[model samples]
Every structure is written in C-alpha cells, then in structure tokens.
Target: MVLDPSRYQDHRTWKMTPGLLRARQPYFRNNMIGLAILAGVTAGIYSYTYRFLHKDNDFADVPIPPIDEKELEQLKKEYEQHKNERQ
Candidate 1:
C-alpha cells in the first residue's frame, strides 16, 4: 500500500536551530559524560592488566657470558687483514 506523503511531512519539517540546540544541551552533556566514563574505565582496565602480566619479569640476574679477549683479537685482526686486501 502506498503511504501518503503528507503524513510524513512533519518529520522533515524539523530544523536544527539555536533554541533547539539549547533545549537538547543537557542530553548532549550527559552522553559526553557517559562516553568519557566508559573510555576511562577501559583504559584503567588495560593498564591494570598490563602491569599485572609483566610484574614478575626481572632481567637483572640474567648472566651474560664473558667474551674471550683472544678470540675477539683474532677476529679483529682477520677483519683488518680482509679490509686491507679489499682496498
């Protein structure tokens, strides 16, 4: 069935005016406050989870193997000889 255009004409007649905006100010403010609260809660949860997951990680005691000075010197000498040959 075809709907009468005249019946829906009232829906299109509404225009955004300063007075209308002023009337809806409280609604917009409430929505913004709610969105901010949700974002803050999400960030707080993520921060807490990240800290909790990484709290036990300690790398200070990890022993680094000592480098042999003789082996390093030999490698350096070989590299210098190769460089001199290339030039």
Candidate 2:
C-alpha cells in the first residue's frame, strides 16, 4: 500500500517542530578560543620543525670574549718546549 503525502502534509505544524524551535534560539558562534588553540599548535609545530632543521649548525648568536695576548704567547711557548723535548 502506498502512503498519501497530502494526508500527512495537513497534520504537520511548523510551530510544534523541535528543529524549528531550536533554530530560533541564540547560539554561541564565536570561534576565537578554537582559533587561538589552532594558532598556538601551529606555531609550536613550526618552531620545532625549524629548530630541528637547523640543529646541526651553530645558529645561536653569542658574544665572544677578548683573548689575551699573554695567554696566547704562553701557550705557544709551552707547545715549543714540548715539541723540543719530544725530539
């Protein structure tokens, strides 16, 4: 037996439907929290990948202290005496 669409159409009321009632209520549509989370995760992944890619090289920029001339001369003298003693 086939069902008649016209008989059910007359009994269907838009005012009593749960879907229509829920659609009329205000909803929280702001996605700022989700966006911030995504941004943080993306930044963390990018920074880690960049660090891994440059791990083998000395990329850190640090200041060097001045070397003393006396220390250099003393090291040279010690090396010369050791070499002479070995011969």
Candidate 3:
C-alpha cells in the first residue's frame, strides 16, 4: 500500500534527538550503536548455533576424523601381529 507522504511528513521538523527518526514518524532511529550491537549479537548467536548444529554434516569432506582413528590403527597392528605369527 502506498502511503501519502504529505499526510505523515513535512520538511519543517522539530527534532528532540538527533538521528532519532524521520520527520513525523513515531519510530525512532536513535541509539544506532545499540541497534548495531543488537544486530551483531543476533547474527553471532545465529551463526554459532547454526554452525554447531550443522558443521559436521555440512562439511563431510573435512579431514578431521569424527571418531577415534586409533581403532583402525589397532586393527592394523593386530593384523600385522597375526601375519607375523603365521609367517
């Protein structure tokens, strides 16, 4: 819906706080620093949560073994022992 700008706004504005809001708008844009901080915090939280939930699944090719690689090495050692015993 298109709003009539003339009904809500005027060039002559009496601002109580600088950078607080557009002329005639009730919403305030004051404390831009706080808004930025909140946005950054939200984004950081979301990113952290999303990564924690999905990192391993998404990065299937990641070289880091998800489980103990020692199991494989133990199996190999066992096989080698058995082969040596046989020979």
Best by TM-score: 1
TM-score head-to-head 2 vs 3, winner: 3
Off by over 4 Å in 3: 1-8, 11-30, 57-87
lDDT (Cα, tens digit) per residue for candidate 3, span 1-87 = 364334334436532444334442553445666799999999999999998987666667779856578898998999999999999
Q: Candidate 1, TM-score vs. the true structure?
A: 0.44
Candidate 2 deviant stretches above 4 angstroms: 1-30, 57-87
Deviation (Å) of 52 in candidate 3: 0.2
Candidate 3 vs. true structure, TM-score: 0.33
Candidate achieving higher TM-score, 1 or 2: 1
Please provide, for model 2 over 1-87, each residue's C-alpha lDDT reduced to its tens digit, 9 standing for 90 to 100. Answer: 354334324344423355544664444244666788899999999999999988866745766778799988998999999999999
lDDT of 3 at 49: 94
Q: Estimated TM-score per prediction? A: 0.44, 0.32, 0.33
Deviation in Å, model 1, residue 78 alpha carbon: 8.7
Tell me each candidate's RMSD, in Å, in order. Answer: 7.9, 16.5, 14.1
Worst 10 residues of 3 by lDDT: 15-24
